[model samples]
Target: MTTLTRTLTDTQVVAKRNLLKIVRVPEILVAVLISPIMFVLLFAYVFGGAIDPGDGTSYREFLIPGIFAQTVVFGATFTGAGIAEDMQKGIIDRFRSLPMSQSAVLAGRTLSDVVYNVLSLLIMALTGLLVGWRVRGSLLDAAAAFGLLLVFAYAVSWIMALVGVLVPSVEVINNASFIVIMPLTFVSNAFVPLDSFPPALRVFVEWNPVSTLTQACRELFGNTNPAAPVSDAWSMQNPALYTLICVVVILVVFAPLAIARYRRTSR
Candidate 1:
């Protein structure tokens, strides 16, 4: 076999081995499974009545895409926590001593987490459907919307994994990651229209990645119209562009940092 082919084979083997560990410990899957459902239930019943979407759609429809964004963001915290646990247990140290590609360890963990994210989204989508959350867009648009969400989720996973490598304890990983993520989720348009916020708050909300992602998904699902004014010169124009930009920004900023931190920690 060619050297390139051999390298690819080795990475795949390492990735598969990590995935096998996930299969044996089903609780990891369970935690991923429960989070999205909890978000749907808590937000749909609790805060749905308080929010005015202005589009005349039921609150549930208006909120699903936002909840999808929020859930994926919340779900990413596990990436760091899991990695920290493995490191503390010496699993990562042992892997470092092996003749495997350095990238494979982080790649495997992040990719596996993406699979878990997909399953979580699927389950939440099914539950949302049962509760009357319908996508008004075409099937292609719905698929595109979901595809973007997964891409965003995967991008965020790298950042979270970097935190895992840098933090001294798994407990810190659990608390500190959410302290950053939860505020971003709440301060954005996820739970309310950005117009309702005061001017100072509105500026921050406009630039938030979670808001951009939610607006993109909402437009894709036809839950809200793109031509409608979110603010002056910001009408949710070009949702695909927004998703693309967020994904690119995240990958460009976090990918190298994650790799560098992993290499340093694994040493």
Candidate 2:
């Protein structure tokens, strides 16, 4: 077999092993599935009334995409925490002794976490539907929106992979990721209209990729209000393209770095 084929085969094996952990340890699946559901309910009923998407759009519809973006972004933490746990438990040492490609270890971990994110998104989608969120776009567009989310989430997993390989423990990985992610998700137009923000912060929010991701999903899902004040920022105006670019940039910068870090740390 070619080197690339061999690597892929190894990666699949490792990914299967990692995925099986979810079945063996059901709590991991439960936690991954529950958090998104809770977020859907909390934001849909508790805070949905106070927020408006303008143009008479249902707040629940506006809210669900933002929740989806946030959930998937937060789900990237699983990659970091899982890696940190493996490193702490000396699983990396065991993997190193195997005949498989070394890169498979990181690839497999990130790949498996995509399934976790998928499950999270599925549950959140169901909960959102129950709470009055509906897709106004065509089925193809909704599929594209979901595809964009998964693509972005996959890129984020590489970043967490680097953090996981570098961090001393799972707790540190979780804490470190939270500090960065919380601000990114909140400061964006995710939960509220960008018009509500102060000018200075609005500029950041307009350009924030998280904001663009949410905007892209809203646009693709047909959830945006015609009367809503839109950002003239290039990123916001071209959210889908901009988000795709961000995904490419992130993977280019972080994927190799994560792999290199894993190799060095495992040794």
* Index of the highest-TM-score prediction: 2
Q: What is the TM-score of each candidate against the true structure?
A: 0.92, 0.97
At residue 164, candidate 2 shows an lDDT of 90
Q: Top lDDT: which candidate number?
A: 2
**lDDT string, candidate 2, 4-111, tens digits:** 998899889989999999989999899899999999999988998888767578888888999999999999999999989999999899988877787998999889
Worst 10 residues of 2 by lDDT: 258-267
5 Cα displacement, candidate 2 (Å):
0.6
lDDT tens digits by residue: candidate 1, 6-125: 557765776677668669998878778887888898888898788777766788988999999998888889888878888889988987888767777777777777877889899999
Tell me how far the alpha carbon of residue 2 in candidate 1 is from the true structure, in angstroms, after superposition: 6.8
Clashes of 2: 0
Q: How high is the CA lDDT of each candidate model?
A: 0.82, 0.90
In TM-score terms, candidate 2 sits at 0.97
